[model samples]
Target: MNTKQLIEEAVSLPLEERAIVVDSLLRSLNQPESEIDKQWANEAKRRLSELRSGHIEAIPGNDVFSKVWDRFEK
Candidate 1:
């Protein structure tokens, strides 16, 4: 049917059902990820390279948490 008819039918749906329809429509659209995704991937690669080259010290999680708690308690 026409856009107006389709919209009226959609609006008549239950709230949860309408939400599902909207979600499906959004997912069907072709969209690119945000710039932050690209930046995150690049930063992850850089960190991996640094780890491979031994450019940074790897601290244990327990030690890190201990230090955090020490400072937090003071």
Candidate 2:
């Protein structure tokens, strides 16, 4: 549908449904990737490289969470 008709239909939705529709519509718009995503992608590449080169360390999940909680609860 054309923009005006589409907007009219969106406005005619019930209040809550209209809000959901608007939020979904806005979120469907293109967004640029964040810098953290780029950094994570690079780090993943480095890790894969290290794994291929047989250089790796295994850390338990409990240890990771303990460290995270220590800093988080501080």
* Each prediction's TM-score versus the true structure: 0.52, 0.38
Report the C-alpha displacement of residue 40, candidate 1, in angstroms.
Answer: 1.1
lDDT of 1 by residue, 1-74 (tens): 99999999999999999999999898679565779779999999999899889998778999999999999999
The alpha-carbon deviation from the true structure for residue 21 of candidate 1, after best TM-score superposition, in angstroms, is 18
Q: Write the per-residue lDDT of candidate 2 for residues 1-74, one digit (tens) a residue.
A: 99999989989989999999978877689564789789999999999998788898767999999999999998
Name the runs in model 1 displaced over 4 angstroms. 1-33
lDDT of model 1 at residue 33?
78
Candidates in order: C-alpha RMSD to true structure: 8.9, 8.2
For candidate 2, the lDDT comes to 0.88
Best by lDDT: 1
Weakest 10 consecutive residues of candidate 1 by summed lDDT: 27-36
